[model samples]
Target: MKSLRLIFCALWTAAFVSGCGAYSFTGKSTLSSDVKTFTIRDITLSAPSSYATISQEMTEKLKEYYQRNTKLKLVPQNGDISIEGSIVDYRTDGVAASSGGDKAAMNRLTIVIEVVFTNKFNEEDNFEKDFSFYLDYPQNQTLQEAEKTLVPKILDQLVLNIFGDTVAKW
Candidate 1:
């Protein structure tokens, strides 16, 4: 019985080691090595409005994500990696037109962001990209409040999308 226990332990250790070597979390490890610390500069707003505050909120959330999910640290100034960008566009349009060609019972908010990710070490070309997101607002709800609620959720998804595309290589 002791010999059998020993063999089982050996097999388990081997399997664990092999698993670590072979495993890859596609969207989780893209910047694993090139970036040790990251700095997200203030995001520029396309048009001035209450939404301007959303930019700073997004920066903080992204920094938190990196801190929690990766080994990367968040630096105040120059760091191995940096992200800077602007809010390029913001618009609200009607969704689902009515039979009379009028705006229907819902509206859509579209936010577009232009971003650049730089590798200070010159490990690769700077990444410049644009991404957008849309959310439907019920006709009865206040646009202002809806906008406020959507900002964080939109920022969260945008962060995931940006990181996955540029760093995660997804």
Candidate 2:
């Protein structure tokens, strides 16, 4: 019985180590061994709205997310993985109206981000996708009040989706 337990433990450890070697625990990336660096070009603001900071904030946040979660070096160009795109939409609409139907009870703010990810080492994984997310707030609140709080929250999910599609293999 003791020997059987010992063998089981050994097998489990071996499988976990081997399985994890090809992927990052956080990003869940199955990055090629030859891949060493990554690049993120400036994201453009294509959305026709007053949320001018979306592009800048998204670019910086994506850079930081990859830098924090991956082992790859951040290069200006010619990297193993390259990413770029735009903020394609910034929309707000009433989600729910008051019982009287005279005023909105809740409003939603949505952001759309489109990205093209190229994996030079594995061209099969290259893709262009649009990631979108939203936040709901009281209709009485001004966009200025809701914008500051909602932008980052929605952007976080958008970044996560992009990261997952590009590198996480999820």
Candidate 3:
């Protein structure tokens, strides 16, 4: 009876460990390619000199997201597909304001991007589309800090828009 109990406990522990590895492949919902490799070319930023960091930030985010969510490797060249793009527009509008002042109490920043995705093997898979995102600036914050914060928010939205179209079904 003692030997039987020990064997049963060992079997139970093994089964538990195996079950943990049997997850439901959730990452597949976000990426379509089974190709396991891709490249995102350097995005062009068509803004003032201050906006240069936004380009690098978006590129890094794209690479990081793919690395974290899929089994694919980011290849520098000769990839199965490539995503290239430019920042077409950037604007700031007041969303809320003090009644007596020209300055805004709160502001919203919108960034518009035009992206071209190309599949080297299949022209039919290539796509060119525009996406836009906005971030709100706090009234108490300096314009400089607002500028810094806005880029990440836009990049986050850009990633969501790209991933949804490419992999997630609508």
Candidate 4:
């Protein structure tokens, strides 16, 4: 009976594993097999309000994200896939009003990126789009104080969104 039970458990485990053959924990990428390399041209800052280093920071983060998440190699120019873009908008605005309605209770920092994706293997997948993200902070804090913590978070999400649109096709 013990031997029969062990065999049954083995069969169950195998069945479960086989059923997940198509499942990918990292999420599915629609990139074709022919796409083995990618390039990200230097990101430019068009927003006068944005800091000087923001463009460089964003470009490096994007490259690192793609390298870590995908098997594609990085090339300097004209790879199977290429991305080029500029930061079009970066500004702060009042989001929530105080009880007196004369002042803001919360402030939001927003960033907008204009992206152009080129797919050498699949021209139909090429696209140009704008991706935006924001972070909210209490009105008591200055923009300088909030920016240090919020900018990184916003950039990370922007990169993820760009990745989803270009490769994952989500």
What overall lDDT goes with each candidate model?
0.77, 0.89, 0.75, 0.93
* Per-residue C-alpha lDDT of model 3 across residues 97-151, encoded as one tens digit per residue: 7777877888887888788887666667679999888888887886577887678
Backbone clashes under 3 angstroms, per model: 0, 0, 0, 0
Across 47-120, the per-residue lDDT of candidate 4 in tens digits comes to 98876688999999999999998999999998899999999999999999999999999999999999999999
Query: Highest TM-score, which number?
Result: 4
Error at 93, model 4, angstroms:
0.9
Per-candidate TM equals 0.79, 0.87, 0.72, 0.87
Candidates by TM-score, descending order? 4, 2, 1, 3
Best by lDDT: 4
Candidate 1: RMSD to truth? 3.6
Residues 33-108, model 2: lDDT tens digits: 6888999999999888847588889889999999998888999998899999998889998999899999999999
Q: What local lDDT does model 3 show for residue 91? A: 79
Total clashes, candidate 4?
0
Better of 1 and 4 by lDDT: 4
Q: For model 4, where is the 10-residue window of minimal lDDT?
A: 21-30
Taking the tens digit of each residue's C-alpha lDDT, what string does model 1 give over 36-120? 8878888878754447587788677777776777677888879787888888877878887766776577888877889888878
lDDT of 2: 0.89
- Greater-lDDT candidate between 1 and 2: 2
- lDDT of model 3 at position 154: 79
